[model samples]
Target: MGTIVKQNKQLYKAISENKRFSLAIFICFMAILKIQYSNVESTEYLGIADTKEININSSHSVKIRNIHVIPGQTVEEDELLMELERPDLDLRIYELESQLNELKAENSFNSEMNKELKSVKVSNNENMDSPLQIKINSMTKQLIILKRKKADLFVFSKRAGVIGSINVKVGEDASPFTPLITMHDSAPSMIKGFIHESIYNKTYKGQKVVVTSISDPNKIMDAVVASVGNRIVEYPVRLRKSEASVTYGREVVIFVSKDNPFLIGEKVQIKSFEKPNEIMTAHAQAVPVRKIEDVIDLEIGVDIENTKVEPSGLVYIKDLNQTVMISDDTGRKDRPYIYTVNNSGLIDKEIEIEGVKAISDMEAISMDENGIIYIASSMSEKKNGKVSDKRKKLLMIERNDFNFKAIGEVNFYDALNKVAKSNKSEEWAQVLLAKGNKKIRINIEGILVKENTMYFGLRSGSKLTKDQFVLLKINDIKSVFAKNAIDADQISIQANVAFPIDSDFKNEGVSDIALINGELYVLTVNNTGKEGGRVLKTVLADPSNHMTELKRFKGLKPEGITYDTSASKFLISFDQGDKKSKLLLVDKF
Candidate 1:
C-alpha cells in the first residue's frame, strides 16, 4: 500500500506541472496578440504639426489722404483711406479750356456776318470759319476748370479697413502715385498661405482647414479654402510681411469663420483636409496587346459568312468588359491555356491555344469577347519566333496578278569610272553618276530603246513618250530590261520633232518622271549628290512645245513613283539615308 501511494503522488504532481505550463503559454500568446492589435490601430490615424505666427503688417503700399479719422480710431466700410494728389493734371486742363474759349469767340463773329451768302458760298464759309460761333464759351471754360480742381482734392480709402499708419502730413506734398499711409483690417480675418504644385492637385477649393494661432497657442480657428490662385508664383512671399527666406511654395487664401477672431499678421498653423485620389479599375480582359511598330494589326476573329477566321492580326472591339479566352502559355509546355469570358458571363479556363499572334517583334496578343484580339504596344521584350510566325500567317492578302523582279546591280564606283572614260568632262560625268548612284533602284519600264534613241512611257499603255530624249553614251546605259510588256504595247515613233528646252533644264536634265496635274513632271536633282535630292516639274502637253521647268523642292528624292487614284496624289519615296525610307505626299502636283 505504501508503494502504491507513492506512485499515485508522483502521477498527480506530473499532471499538475503540465497544467501550469499550458496556462503560462496561453497568457504569453494573448499578450503578443494584444501588441499586434495596438500596432494596427495606430496606423489608422495620422497627424502632422507645423510652426506658424501672426502677421500684423503686409507688404502692399497704399495712398492715404482724408484726415477725418485719427490713428487707433475704428472705421466703417467704404470710409476714406486716403486721397491721391494730381496738381500737374489740373493745371494742364485749365490751360486747354482757356484756349478753347478764345477760338469760340472768333467763330461767333464770322457766323453773324455771313447771312447774304449763296448755297455754295455759305457751305464754303461754314467750313472755313465755324469755330467762333459759340455764346456760352466763357461759362463752359469756367466749369471745366472747376471740375479739374475738384479731382485734385478727391479722397480714396485703401481697401475697406482700419488706418494703420499715417505717412502723409496735412501740408506735405504728395505725388499722384506715391503711398501716403498703411491701412489694415483685423476683423476675424483669414490666414492666407500657399501650397506647391506637387500638392496642389491633392487639395480643392472649399476644403475644411484647421488654423492654429502662433501668438495664442490655445486659439484655434475653423476655416475653409476661400480661393485658389489662377497662376503659379515663385516662392519667397513678396506680398506677405514675413522675413523668412525660403523659396518655392504656393499661395492660398483661407477665409476664417466669424466665430474665430484671429488678429491680422498673426501666423497660424493650417492643416488642410484633402480627399484621396481616385483610382480606376477595369477587367483584366480590357487590356490590349499592341506591337511596337504597328498596334493596328492585332489578330481578331471575324465572322465571314457564318465562318470565323483571323484577319491581319487586327481586331475591332465592339464592347469592353467581355473577353474571349485564347490559349497561351508564353511558350511554356505546361498545358498552354487561356481563360475566356463568353457572352453568357461564364468564365472558361484551360482552353486550348494555337499561338499568341503579335503585331510586331515587340508586342503580344490579347483577346476580348467575340474572339477579337488586340495588339499590346508596350511589351517588356521582343516576342519570340512563335508569335511572329502566327502573326505572319494571319495577315490578309489581296488577290492580284502583279509580278516584280530584280534585274541587275550597279556598283556606284565602277559606273562612275566608266562614265569618266567616255566623257571628256570628268567633273560633269562624276556629278551626274554620283547623283544617280544615291538612288536605291531606278526602274524604267515601258521604255523603248531603238538605235540610239530611247522613249519613256508615262503610263503602262500610253503610246506617246516625252518629246525629248537625252543623248546617252554606251557607258550611260545601266542594265536595260522590259517588264509587264505585251506585243501590242511596243513604242514605234514615226517622225522626229524639235525638243523644246525650258528654263529648268539649264542645270540638270530630268532624273525621274511622274504624271501630275494631267501633265508629266520631271524630277531634277541638285548638282551635289547629297542625301536629300531636289525635284523639278515639267509640263508635257504637246510634248514638243510645252516643256517648261516649274519649281524645285529640297529634301525630296523621287523613288518608286505611284499615282494614288483614290487620294489623287503622287506617293514619292524619299531615301532617308540608312536603308530606311519615307513617303512624301504631293497633292498639288
Candidate 2:
C-alpha cells in the first residue's frame, strides 16, 4: 500500500512540473514577439519650431494720402479710413462725355425718320419729312451724354480692411499710378515661413499643427496645412486661423479667444509632425530648439528609412543606428569636411560639402584633398569687368591737317552767306583775311592778316588796316607761294589758319544728340548766361522740318546733357544759382 501511494505522488509532481514548463515557454515567446513589433513601429521624427505670421495688407504697395488710424488703433470691417483724390482722371472723363452726346443726337434723328416712314401707309416724296423724327433725335442725344458722364466717375476701395497708412494730404496733387493708402484685412490670416527645397517633399497637407500666438502668450490655436505653392524660393506659409482668431501679419485685427488678444502681424510658435502619429525616437539634444539651420557642432543619429533625412541635416530618417554624428573639422572657405569614426574606433573618414543655409549653420556639401570638407560661406560674391576711361567720353573729331585763307576783301553780305553755308552739316570753319598792307617801296608791299573766327563775329572788322584788304572767301592757300609777294596780277593771300573745337567741355558748353525709340533728340542749353533751356525731338529723316519741342523745362542755366540707354530717358543737370544742381528726367520724347 505504501509503494502505491509513493508512485501516485511522483506522477502528480511530474504533471505539475510539465504545466509550469509550458507556462514559462509561452511567456518567453510573447516577450520576443513584443520586441519585434516595437522594432518595426519605432521611428524618430525631426521637428522644427515655426512661427505663424499674418499678412494684414493685401497689396504689396500703397500710396498714403492720410493715415487716419494709428498703428495700435483697432478697426472694424468696411470702415472708411481714408479718401483718395484723382483730379486728372476727372477732367479726362468730362471730355469723353461731350463727344458721346453729339453722337446720340444724330442717331435719334435717323430712328425717328424710319418710324415715320413705317407709320405712313402711302409712300411719297412729299411725306418724306417727319417732325417726329427731329424730336426723337434730340431725346436720344441727351441720353447718350448722361451715360458717358457716368462712366468717368470711377472709384476703388484701396482695399477692404482697416487703414494702415495715408501718405498724401488734402489739396495735394497726387502723382498718377502712386499708392495713396494701405489697408489691412482682418479675416483669413496665414503664416509665412521659409523652408529649404530639399525638405519640401516631406511636408504635405492635412498635417496637424499646434499654433501659439506670440502676442497672446496663453492662447493656443489649432489649425491644419492649407495650400502649398509651387515656387521654390523663400515662400510664405498661410495658416487659416480658426474662427474668432485674430489676423497674424497685420496690426489692426485682434482675437479675444484667449486671456490676451493676438496682435496683428505678430508671429506665433508652431509645432507639426511630418507623418501620421508614429513611434518617434529622437535624442533630447537632436531636436532643434529654434530652427534646424541654427544648430551647430552637434552629432546626430537618424533612421535609414526616411530618405529626406538620409545622410542627415534637415532631412527625414527611418532608423536610428544607421546614422552617426561626427565632428566638422573642415575650414570655412574649404569644402565642408566631417570626421567619422571607423570600425576600429578611430576617426578615419571625412565628408565634403553637401549643402548650405543662410539662417541655419553652414552645411558641408562637398570635400577636397587632405580629407578636408568645404562649406559655403554666407556671403555671395560677384565679379564684374572694369570700365575704361576712354569709353566714358565720346570722340567727335580725329586729328587732321586743314587750312583756310582769303584772297581779297569780301563784302559783308557775301561773307555772311559763306559762313552760313559752311555750317550746313553741323561743322564750323575758321575764317582768315588780310587786315592791312605795308608799302616797302613802289615795287614791294607787305600785308598783315587776322585768321581766327570767333563764335559770334561782326560783319564789320573793328580792327583793320586801310591798305590791307580783308578777304573772307578764301578756302585754301599754299604756304610756298604766299611766303613773300608782289606782282600786280597775283593777289596777296592770308596765311594758314586753324581753329580746334573743344568737344571735351562738359558743363555749360557741351551739346548732345541722341536717337531714342526711333526719334532724334537734340539737347541744347544756352551757357551764355541766358536762363534758356530746350529739349527737342523729331524724325531722324526730317529733323529740321518736323522739330517738336517736347520738354521746355526752364530752371538752370543749362550746361551738359547725358542720355541713359538703360532707362530709355535723358537727364539734364543744371547749375541753378549758388552751385545748387538740379536733375530733370525727360521721359517722353
Candidate 3:
C-alpha cells in the first residue's frame, strides 16, 4: 500500500513539472513576437537630385499662348521663353498706341503751324499758348507710356540656361505667380531624397548625410544636407512595399561632389541615419504689435481716381451702376470726400451731406439690397486696444439719382463694448515677449448684411483661444430709428465668433472680412511683424471649423479685401501710409 501511494505522488510531481516547463516555453515565444513594430525607420524615398536649376515664376496670373523653347533646348540671355496672352490688356495697349499716334500727328501739325506763325511774326501770345500746344505736350507723354506697355507683353529669360522642365503647354491659362519652368545650368549634379518621417526630425541643413548606391551598397559618398523643404510631399517613386502614410516626406536636397556618378533622379540609400538631436517647428513667427488709433483706416479699394483724401469705405450700387468711396477724413465743409466712381474707371461725382453731430472718421462702408449704404467707424483705439470713451459712429445713406443723402445714424459703442467685455483677448498668445497692458477692445473693422443679419468683424483676438467676430440680428431697421438716430445695443445679437489661439497664423485676429461666393473670407496681418499675414476662408455652414488658407501677403500690408463679380477676382487695398494708396487685383485661390 505504501509503495502504491509513493508511485501516485511521483506521478503528480512529474505532471506539475511538465506543466511549468510548457508555460515557460510559451512565454518565451510570446516575448520575441512583434505586435506593432513601426516600419517608418526603414523607409527611403526616390527624388530628383541632379542639375543646378532655377525655377522661372510668374508674378501675376496669365495665359501661356506661346512656348519659344522646348525642354533640353539651350537659351541665351534676353531670349524669349514664353508669350502670355492678355486679350483685354492687349486691346488696351492697342487703343493707347493708336491714340498716341493720332496725338503725335496732331502735335506735328501744331508745331508746323506755330513755326508759320513765328515766321509771320504773329504778335498774339494767346495763339502760341492755344489748346493745341497743351494737347501736343500731353500726347508726347502718353506715347512714351504706350511704348512701355507694348514691350511688357512678352516673357524673357534673364540668364542663359537649358530648359530643364516645362510646366505649361500651348494654349493654357498659366499663373506666372508660381514657377512655370525650370532652367538648369550644366554644373555638377546633386542628390535629393525624401527623408522618412520617423527620421525626418533628425535632418537639418548643414548636417552630414551618407549616400550609397542602391544597386551596389559598396559604392558610397558622404554629403551635406543643402536644404530642407517646408512642405510635405509624396515620394516621386514608390518603393515596393511602402505604406501610404510613410510614403510622404519633407524633400531634402544634399550637396554632392562634381564627380558623383549618381544619375539625375536615381535611387540611393542613406546610411548612419540617426534621430535629430532636437527638432524645431512653428506655425508662424510672432510679429511686433502696432499702436492703436481712434480711427482705424479700413482702406477699401475702388476703381476710382483723383480723390482728395484716402478712401476708407467702398460700396457698389448695382441700380445706379456706380461704386461709392468715402474718405477716412473728418466731414468738413472744406473736405468734400464722398465720391461716386463709374465702372469705366472714372470718378463720376462727389456728394455733400450735412452731419447732425460729427462724421470725423468713417472706416467701413457697404450697400444693402435696398440701395441703403451702411457706414461704420472703428470703435477701438488699436494701440491700447481700448473702447472709446465716446460713442461709436454708424451712418446710412440713400442715393437719389447721383446724390448720396444720409438716411440714418447710430451710436454703436455700447454694443461693441458689451461684446468685447465678455471675452478676454489673447494678444500675447503669439508674441514672444510683449506685455499685456491693455484689455482687448472689440474694434469693428468691417460689416456685412446677409439675410437680415449683420456680421461685424473683430480685428483683434488671441490665436488658439478666441478669434474675434460677431453676428447681430436687427429687426425692422427703419422702425428702430427715431429722428435719424438709432442705438445698436437695442438690436438682437447672436453669438460672436472667436478663433482659438492654436491656428498656424496666430497673428492679429483679422483686418477685414468679406463674403465671397458663399464663403466668408477673413484677412489677418502680423501685428508683431514676425510673419506675413494670411487670408483665411470658411464655409458659412460651419464657421466653427478652422479657416483654411486662401491667400498670403508679405511686405504688402493689405487692409481690406472685396470680391468683384465683374472681374472674378479679389481686389485688395494696401495701406500706403502717407504715399499714394494702391489696389491690387489678384486671382482668387
Best by TM-score: 3
Candidate with better lDDT, 2 vs 3: 3
Candidate 2 positional error at 266, Å: 3.3
Query: Which rank order by lDDT, best down to worst?
Result: 3, 1, 2
Better of 1 and 2 by lDDT: 1
Worst 10 contiguous positions by lDDT, candidate 2: 439-448
Root-mean-square deviation per candidate: 31.3, 33.2, 21.1
lDDT of 3 by residue, 1-589 (tens): 9999999999999999999999999987776544322211222444444666778766556777888899999897679988776665667667777876786678677667867775665445654466765665676666565555446658787555678889888778876566788987444356767776666766665444567777766656655565688887777644424454446778887766545666655577754333333211111222221122111223222211223455555565555645566556543322334765333223335455534335545566766666676777766564555444332666667767876666666666553334334432422212111134223334556676665456666554332223454444454455434433334343543335555444555545566666777787777655564435567788654566766776676665555666566645566655454665545555556
State the lDDT of candidate 1 residue by residue for 1-589, as single tens digits.
9999999999999999999999999999999978744422100111122112212211223233346666666666446544544454556567666776666655655555555444535675454534443334554656665675555355544234566666676645654445455555545445567666566554455444566665665776444454567777665454334657554445676654323556656566666533232111111111222221221211111101111111101111223322322221222222222332222112211232232222222112222222223221111112341212222211111111111112322232223234343552442333233234331111121122223223332111111224333322221122321211112112232212323444433333233444444554444433334433334443433444445544444544332233444445444433333332334434553
Which candidate model has the greater TM-score, 1 or 2? 1
Model 3: CA > 4 A from native: 1-308, 331-336, 341-349, 354-357, 382-391, 415-440, 461-505, 528-532
> Candidate 1: misplaced stretches above 4 Å?
1-67, 77-85, 115-152, 193-206, 212-222, 226-252, 257-260, 274-589
Q: Against the unseen true structure, what C-alpha lDDT does each candidate score?
A: 0.37, 0.33, 0.57
- By lDDT, the best candidate is 3
